[model samples]
Target: MKKIYITFLFAAISLFSSCDDWLTVEPKDMVTVDKALTTPEGYTSALVGVYQILQNVYNPGGFVMGSGVDTFANIYTEPSIGFSQSLNSAYNYNFSDTSYDNSSGAAFLQMYKAITNLNVILSSIETTEVLTAEQKNFVEGEARALRGFLHFDIWRIYGTAPDDNAGTSNLILPYSLEVSNEFIPYLNYNDYFANILSDLEQAKDMLSFSDPIIYYSNELLNVEGSIEEYEDLGWYNRQNRFNYYATLGALARVQLWMGNKEQAYEYAKEVVDAQNEDGTRKFRLGTSTDMGNTDLALFVEQLFGVETLGYDDTSYSSYTAHCVNSEYVLNQVYPSSSDIRKMNLFTTLTSNALVYNAQISLKYSLMSENDASAYKNFPIIRVSEMYLILVETAPTIAEAQTYYDTFANSRFDENVTLTEGNLQENILNQYTREFWAEGQIFYTYKRLSLTSLPFSGQEMNTDKYKIAIPSGETNSDL
Candidate 1:
């Protein structure tokens, strides 16, 4: 599908300002929320606006410094030229002054803006006369799911670890329930998690009847026909939206992060089992053959992602600047030829004399040659992540091995096997390989608090793990 650009005129919604506090602008919009949702087309357009923040956050070069989750996580390699210039603070954990720069701060601000828009859509949908109840539920489900997702990410970046039972007393962020400028105080980690999960559970119920993205084909055949085409019913590709399965996947991820092993395993197992053995599943793991002949490509059967319109044309240079000549990590960790990830998803640049052979991440940057592979939607969750969750949270080592081997067998050219003894070792290895440049590796280490990383000699350090609140937000002038 051609990437659709939904114009979110922030100027129109000046009431939802991108201010330091993110809430001190006039309520000026060319179209009001009630009028905007009066038609299905307008409703979809507004829904698309809620998704715009993902593209902004995932865009490689926009606010490299403020991209705290990946930057602080140390997800990329130090460039040959700017090893000390660019990412010096993040790599060294120097986030006191420079961590919350304008770009990073803007990312944090934009998510709130998106949430504000989502809140408007959710409140208006109840009284929206033009849309069917099913249509309203679809929009409500996606809005709540996206809200939960954005808030959860905010917590990850700013708050203490969810599993920190001791840190439950400290509040970090407010769960914004309505579109208002009122300063919401931070809830403790446990309370914050409860609110986020509550939204996700509501999302799951709302999207139960909604269509899902079919795995191998990446199509949404379920929502194709019979519905009144609102500007041709643009919702067919529900993969771009947070469908039912996506919420399940998110539940699995959140549960695992919170240290709830049994619940995490159950949720992940549900997502994994959502795919059919007969190949009719809404989502499944991609094969090496599925990656096609291109060296620069992303696995397209993503459970949840945002379609990035003109991403390659606009942001490729900025993305490569941070990634191209930097020290690539897969070179050190992925030593096996049987693993197809090294061959399909990664490309080596030997011309960089400083790093010798920098293995650049082609996960989201492969849109140059093939349009088919260029769906720049940053993947929020994937099928393999469920398998990884199961591996880490299973009740027994034997059960963990069952999950591990299923993933290993599918990813490798030759059949691969793992024993109970090597379960922890291999899970970390798989995390590095599977989530290489997708901005997940650091969280894996942070959540688990591993003393050492897989390839790099970087150990668990206090500076690297914590991100400071932006000075603007810290002011008592709310």
Candidate 2:
């Protein structure tokens, strides 16, 4: 029996009353679990609270995406002085250090905390009388999809790479499916992955018919309509939630991670080829026009994202505080000055007496004061990633090149060719260019089992790739 330290009873109750502007709910007075679960509105608020917990896990300067995991991949420069000791520790792969607790420790706990909330929702939804059949499907599908998504992220961060055969058989983390203090057993890599796939598949089946994202255009789905216009339902901001396509996208990502290339390609192709009723692409790549308008986060391409109100004012500051190597940014990541990302996604600070010229990412920074909310989204997955998956998993070199060319052309004015020899290298380069500061390049490095990292030339091994389970968790199990 594994005794994981989780605050279910109190934390789950508190989540019901907490409301955010994006969730579009008024704060409720704290009530008992039975009272809260009695209403359909309560279920929605509970789900919204799960998302809020997720924000903490992915919070700026925290572990998962922010500066923490990115440091392990050497995305940021080691400051000359000790400005951010925690970030420095992360860059050095010192996961066991107390200084790094806020990153790895907090993320691990919060992720499970969110999972517990999802289980609480799932446990009550089936028997709840307030929801119609369609509403039940809608809510259950979202909850299950989020459960799989968060678990997969936990596996990515703490467990060994799935390709590592010896590591795959070792017991790692527990896949929490119930809201109880009873001992939950840890699962090995294979069983854990099986559970992840099961949840995602079940969610996909449910969302396929019920989610409005299947029937509406991206424009109509994300519109900021009034509560009266949307009939006071939770259907307005479809992108922020885990909709049908997002479930498919997650399936694609998971399949690729497990090395099921054919299944991965099929799942990714579905997202890339999705269409509106009139035949417009459901989700298109971000264009020069988006760059020109200072839409740095590329709102149109985001398949799934979290809405962090005041992100520009809060998380943006901590994220940009970590600087990048100017030479690496110029020569390796973005070689072409004409590339859209180079032109808009980065800004360089000129040298002064104390420091050399430093390059910083503007991907999450506020470029427009008129509508700062537009830039507040934190992308979890996007259409561009689906295209990249297609490029990697296509049946043949010719087919892969076609997907690669389309994705490359969207970011650069000049034609980017893909040959059989450069296919793998080009894919890596695209990841660095596209996902910098987005907290994905490290996973790419681990998935491919590459020993050396770009820019930093840091040699890697399984120890560096797999973060240690926090001491609190390990101790609780004993």
Candidate 3:
């Protein structure tokens, strides 16, 4: 199916201001809830609207700082170019004051903005009589899950996030249920994760179908479920509703971050169990075909496919910056044939360190057919991710070896086998190839809290992983 996600005009529209700056992408105006969803169809469309924003606004993180021009690359790039920097482990960012920009923050703000859109739908759900109770429950669940997911993202990226459980933090974000101009205290981390999981659990129960719809499986929720796409005539080829499952996947990640390894394992295992054995794991690896390219690059272990919304160009995949544009993570070594990711996602940068040409991307190709050069609803989370996580987090080296081979060999050459003491190394190696340009590397390193990777024969420490909230943030009256 042709993917057509939403896109916002990133014009310089004023936020909390009426300034005429050409850079601000402000809403032309607000519409009442009554008009937005006068019917059931209207309400679901609004949900898709929120999903579109999620896909468009949040791009993945990177392995190292580089030419990507995001905070991700900024850290390594800044320090590499002689800039004094400090690390913030929370976001895995090295945010020296000088490198701050509006891009990453803008994405965070977009997340909140997406939350607001869902909030509007929710506010309407309570009052609208046109939608059924079942529909209302499902939609509300999905909306809450989206909010929790976004807040969770912000919590990870922002240093001092709010928590409903720990109400008395010195710094916290305000919780808004309606349109408001007042700044609120942030929820502490405990409350934050709690609410995020709460939403996911609820949505998982209520989520009748995914965007590419799915069904219950007796074969198990791992590598045994069928790989058929559930059709939703009402969904208009949208996957935002399918986000309920992803909510759980993301929760597993959140739990892992919070150091609840057991819970993380449970959550991840659930995803693995939710897959079909045909290698179409819950979040199966994306073949070069998945990228819609003739090149035979295969990205193994597509844990979760984040739906990609609309775009205006082929210059980049949100992850492109980390792959081809920056340090060239793929060129770090000769990737195996089983590791078809670089072959399909990037063109080798063969410039002898001079011209440095060739691009790493299979995503931007969709720009041509898209009306405004944008794609939509790329999978954000998948089952394959769970298998990989399960293997890495396995309690025993033997168990880890067993799971790693069972899950990984499907993508790598038969020569690949977990060697003694190389379990972690192999896992990280798979992690790198699996998410080469996708930005999960940043999270993996931070999650493991390890420093230094051999890139082109040089040991590099991941600068302390803290992305400084711009100093100007406090200066602004949110």
Candidate 4:
């Protein structure tokens, strides 16, 4: 359980970048942590630094998001030649392979690095004289939420499932709370999740009163305006941040994972029913029109996500090269040809002199003529997922069917029937279609403890669901 902490200097300078005026800190301006955090601008930059880590770790090619996690789910077809060896290892569940282990290990360290930064902010934000009381609440709330968010992912990726009785009792991963290099003891599954929920609940309480998203719509807050206009408004771009709704959404997800079905249903319903002052849904489901216009990431429906740079260029190139599924697999996942996802989310690449013909996902690929900046959104949570949660956690089978019908109607112009037997199958199908390269379907299989995967009928077990902890982490004290 002994873990080393990244120094404040490295966390601040290495992760900090120019996203906005407040966050524009140059690496040349080397200053101690105390001096950097003396001003409101410095604290803001530090928080933005944590977000920057998210942008890096969850980008399309990052281990948690695109190639790594999706490959673990067996979402792609390995080409006859020139495929990435690391991804091939992931697809085969070869976590012990050196390349795959190194990739996953790097991502693990990056997440903890971000957590260290968050701990630094939380430790200093309250007593800082430069920030107002409201500013303190906002910063602390966001830090707590991000802390919970990062720990949840770590547990999902590395810890045993709560459903496993023996695994639940065994000490797993340390939930780091302080910015110290001291050894922290690992906790059982119950204690680990309790820490996650504690952070989230405290965050929810603080953000409810302090977050601007509570009173204003994301449309108005994120609306394009002059620099002076935005400066006057204080905070903008609530969609990308862990806003109030996103906290609730995260709660619902965690509750469902821990088998708190009633709580999950309630939390999800609140988010689904949330509205702006104008009565429009806070986060609406994406439609065919959105896909037709090349907004394939469905930016409108994202509850919480990061706006990434080069998502379509560098990050997506990895997908096009190694993660392309064959036409046959795509058909199996999307049985309804009329489904809008099927129609717009895929394109067949013709065989060339060097590469063979294959079907690839357009979810992350943006057209050149369109506003690429607007489409570079990488969703971590969406309203569509809230509906999915509702379907699974609904009180009765009929209630589940109603939620599914609503979600299905929004995606395409179709009337699909649902019954008790097929309801669970349909839900799984939607996960495959809705979150193809978004890195969620794999976790769904794990949470449900499915003995077989959907498309390939690959055998599954607890060992496959849990990734091996990186060797460096295992032998850290040495």
Model 2 segments more than 4 A misplaced: 1-3, 7-35, 166-168, 226-230, 313-320, 351-355, 367-373, 413-416, 476-478
Off by over 4 Å in 3: 1-34, 59-99, 160-178, 208-212, 216-233, 236-241, 275-313, 317-338, 349-379, 413-421, 453-463, 475-478
Error of 2 at 289 (Å): 0.5
Ranking the candidates on TM-score from highest down gives 2, 4, 1, 3
Taking the candidates one at a time, how many backbone clashes does each contain?
4, 0, 63, 0
Of the candidates numbered 2 and 3, which has the greater lDDT value?
2
Candidates' RMSD to native: 6.5, 3.3, 8.7, 3.8
Tell how far residue 443 is off in model 2, in angstroms: 0.7
lDDT of 4 by residue, 334-413 (tens): 77778899898877777522235677777777732255436567889899999999999998988888898899988763
Clashing residue pairs in candidate 1 are 15-26, 66-104, 215-282, 306-377
By lDDT, the candidates rank as 2, 4, 1, 3
- Candidate 2 TM-score over all chains jointly: 0.91
- Every candidate's lDDT: 0.63, 0.77, 0.49, 0.76
Total clashes, candidate 1? 4
User: How close is every model to the real structure, measured as TM-score?
Assistant: 0.83, 0.91, 0.70, 0.89
Please identify model 1 stretches exceeding 4 Å from their true place: 1-34, 62-68, 79-86, 163-167, 212-232, 275-279, 293-300, 313-320, 324-329, 351-354, 368-376, 413-421, 461-463
Candidate 3 lDDT by residue in tens digits, 377-401: 3334545567677776677767766
Question: How would you encode candidate 1's per-residue C-alpha lDDT over 1-478 as one tens digit per residue?
Answer: 1111112223335533433222221232123444466677667767766665556775544442223455565555543325334355555555554533544566666766677777777777777788787787778888888889878777666656544543446555667666654455567677778888999999988888754343323443434553444225466666677877788888888888887788888888887877543566556677777666442334345778766665663243333345543433565566677678877766666654335566665666565435555355567688888888888888787787777777887788334455667766777778877876567777777777677654446776544555655545543542
Best by TM-score: 2
